[model samples]
Target: MGRLRVASYNVHSCIGIDRRFAPERIAEALLDIDANVVALQELGWHHRGLSNFDQFAYLEKMTGYHVIQGPTKFHARAHYGNAILMREAAHTHQLMDLSWPLHIPRGCILAHTHWKGEPLVVINVHLGLTPWDRRRQLKQLVHEIQSHRNSHVVLMGDFNNWKPASVMFKPLSQLLPECTDQPTFHTRKAHAPLDRIYLSPGLRFDTIKVWHTPITAKASDHLPIVADISF
Candidate 1:
């Protein structure tokens, strides 16, 4: 009687193998998972550097969930980054721009939601490609989590570290248990498990799965990771 479903996905800008970008497929994927909350990476906000695509709105409409976007870079062409979606309406949200030495801007979206009257903080982030940058981003993320020590935290996203053991994992390892119950990412050909879902000690995992449906595989280079938890 104490479990919540969570998922993290990199939508590859919502671009599918059909050579088209569709948010609806992403919605369908989420629906299939039936997660209580989801953290998404590589979500595009601006259509062409000036206009906003209803990406978040589309998902919210399809799934009846509240959406919060955390953009890292805004160019004249488009805005891209992470997002947090939840079944319960968020009381408040914060967009932290974790753009570091990498030219590519990375970010995390912190959302506070009331699930069954209990406050929960979900952080959705995409780390940098380089080991050094990811290490730094990890430190910053751990710092951010430490700032709100009293809150229940769920951190999920694409760490992009092919190796299972790395310094990048240390920052979060000290605070949460790594949900390695399953392998995430690379449904196309098992390229590597680059995605992760880390949960704080306050929460316990009830179910962990990798969404690797035929449709999901074509949706992006990575498969989605879902974890059901209870506090």
Candidate 2:
């Protein structure tokens, strides 16, 4: 059995409460978590002031980790999508496009890595807003994960499920053990739990906690979630 620290976060396009875009602030927040592998969503590129810095690359640089970017949308020179930052180099990776119909472009990023000779798979996803879009994308995610049934999987990201029985999470229940299903949305009000971290039975979970960061009150619309596990 081995142990690892993992975290999932949504950077909200690097926008803060002061209505200013600050990638540095997001990086600082992530540093506080000090996770070995982090799956991040809602990262944007090619913004004016952020010209010289790519959000994903900068975070990796600041944290001294290897990064893998899975772009779902390309705008001019800007690429928007999810990313994975790992303490060790990724042994392999895959990106799936879940751009079904009438949905905001959606995708999932899977990065496979070896830490101390142990195998682990980290999935980073940002699901759709509408029910139909969410349901369809979830199906795609299930199919993808099922194909790798033998591996230890850790699923993390912004799910946007305000309701407990939200159809988006229905499929996930079949494969991963439910850890934390709490409200993580609307930083100021904090009424909804949109972020999540799910682990497979093959892994042992030590504890799980939602990061209701103080900066979260003014950082983004949603608070981050952190989960510590062993296997």
Candidate 3:
């Protein structure tokens, strides 16, 4: 394929900023993007937030894509963390346990996919909250992504880096000469650039936009970042 559209969104576990659970709204937002692959963060499974719904399966059904759920921790009926939804079955997939030594649980999903005829790796991450934790997580994250050297990489998710110049991102400086900052956090106002997508070498970018439709603003706390990319 010449280019595939990829998107990243923090769905806030399908809980809207208004405190209502509307998985359909999330689906609508995704439909608006019409992406080939999506990296989702802050997703919940059978956990209380989902009202016992299998959020992973639901998304797959809604978008007609295969899902790879990467749970950071298990709960009574489900787990919560990051996940990847691809247009086709993943060649391989793994979850990164990003829980810091003594901090909250977090994770990323590594799903190996094919775009056009090239092998591609999607690192779907939802990072830690505290500054201390994020620093360590970044280093660990770098190590994780670097291991898949032979494939074209796409790192995208809710990074939660409040500061625009966070040193925690230095580890990936070589890859981010130009970043797509659409300010996705706090969808109501959307002043924070917390959700992002980074593409590796040889991949080209045609468009980078925020899907901020009315429904999207109420679906989650963060708006979706959609990127039109090609290899």
Instruction: Give TM-scores for every candidate, taking all chains together and pairing residue i with residue i.
Output: 0.89, 0.90, 0.93
The local lDDT score (0 to 100) that residue 186 gets in candidate 2 is 73
Which residue pairs in candidate 3 have backbone atoms (N, alpha carbon, C) closer than 3 angstroms, thus clashing?
1-116
User: Candidate 3: where are CA atoms >4 Å away?
Assistant: 45-48, 176-178
RMSD of each: 2.5, 2.3, 1.8
- Each candidate: how many clashes? 4, 5, 1
- Backbone-clash count (model 2): 5
Which candidate achieves the best TM-score against the true structure? 3
The parts of candidate 1 lying over 4 Å away from their true place are 45-52
Q: What 10-residue stretch in candidate 2 is worst by lDDT?
A: 44-53
**Local lDDT at 45 for model 1:** 54
The CA lDDT of each predicted structure is 0.78, 0.77, 0.82
* lDDT value for model 3: 0.82
Largest lDDT belongs to which candidate?
Answer: 3
Model 2, 1-231: lDDT tens digits are 245888887877788767778877778788888788888888875453354357777777777878898878776666778888887778899998988666678889999876556667789988888887788888888888887787888899888677646556767777886556767777777777688888877776687766766665666667787777876
